[model samples]
Target: MLVEPERTAYDLRFRLLGFPIRIHPLFWLGAALLGAFTLNMGFQYLLIWMAVVLVSLLVHELGHAVMFRWFGTNAAIVLYVFGGLAIPQAFVAGRWRRILISLAGPLAGFLLCAGVYVSNRQFHWASNPEGFLTGGREVGFFYLALLWVNLYWGILNLLPVFPLDGGQVSRELCGLVWGPRGTRIALQISLAVAVALVAYSLLCVLTANGPALAVVPWWLPRGTIFTAILFGLLAYTSYQLLQQLRWTDSSWDDRVPWER
Candidate 1:
């Protein structure tokens, strides 16, 4: 599901800071699908949600691309249905380098979130933090969307699930410690984590408006059916990949789907 899609004539192409970027048509569709909930606020807010997704995801991919360049290779960015990928022209040799590249994406997001928070405070965009969140103002919702995508989505991307940045980091670290068997170990870990998340997401859905909500921690995020479906698919994908590796050499190629 995380694999890169085929380029088409309808694809939008551009370059930023010397890095080639491609936006598959499905990228916009995916963003719209995720932002559909914002429709209750009006079409304008839904558009704002898409804008936030674009900026946040572009920053995330740029983070990886910049890190790729620092290691002496150019990388192209592709924004697709799942998210984005920074495909380097040549393989980066070091495990540590790979780990940093994976980490750069989420770190970039965190920095953007910090900038948003600081700017909002400095300018007094919304005096009351609670009121800011609960207010119906478009600008407030825009700011909220920016913060949500960068902060919450960034955190989600860091989960140790296959194809996520954290999963890539986990694979590299496992390889460093376990040698040839690391790929298998990482996949196992990915499967377990993915399954656990799926379960938790379902629980969140069940308790979101139920009497059980009182027992749930206030800080825990409420999950939608979308999240449960997403993680369920990831869990299944991990299981399939794990089975593929099992019949092979107990080793898996540790490259992003775009590279493979």
Candidate 2:
């Protein structure tokens, strides 16, 4: 799941908290496109939605960057279509360290979600609220919407699928349990999870109820049949990556650091 970026269109943006953040033009365009589809609103509201996308995704990636740096490594962030990536240049040793690095991103998201939830509640959304859905008209709606995104998306990213934070943690756990076979087992688990996800999404639709792609965000494929296609692709990619990395001990083997 971790690889060096192609360095295509790497435009250096502003810095914050000592991390030199660079953004790809595709990132903004993607966010704007997602905002346009996800939000049923006008130009001003679309702009606000884009702002939410930018800030929330930035916070999630920052969580990973901060934790990587805290572990004495160099890290940078790239915001992209689906989400952001925190590229770390240092090797994390030990299972605990690896798990910690993987967990940092989702932890950051949940933390942001909690903060936003508190703010939403403070704005009376939890009580006699005011916002897009309520009788009130203010930024409260934005707060609540972002709270939903962060909460749901954070938890979704934690699902035990390869390339996800939870998948990384699951690999560490499997490694501890199965030793050398852990990597394969982890990949197997990922494939299973991906299949289940697609099936669940389908079931939801067939039931004549809420979407089968419940976990799929509005920005993703417009919550259409492509949701199944997306999961299928993830399943295939996981299988392929497992085939590629199966030969190499990608820090998921049972070997000790020096033994590697």
lDDT of 1 by residue, 136-159 (tens): 488788887898899987898898
Misplaced by over 4 Å in model 1 are 126-136, 209-215, 250-260
Q: Specify the poorest-scoring 10-residue window by lDDT in model 2.
A: 129-138
lDDT of 2 by residue, 49-125 (tens): 77888888888889888988888998888776667788888787889988988888878878988887776566655
With a 3 Å backbone cut-off (N, CA, C), the pairs that clash in candidate 1 are none
Clashing pairs in 2: 124-129, 201-212
Error of 2 at 26 (Å): 1.8
TM-score, every prediction: 0.90, 0.80
CA lDDT of each candidate? 0.87, 0.75
Q: How many residue pairs clash in each candidate at the backbone level?
A: 0, 2
Supply the TM-score for candidate 1. 0.90
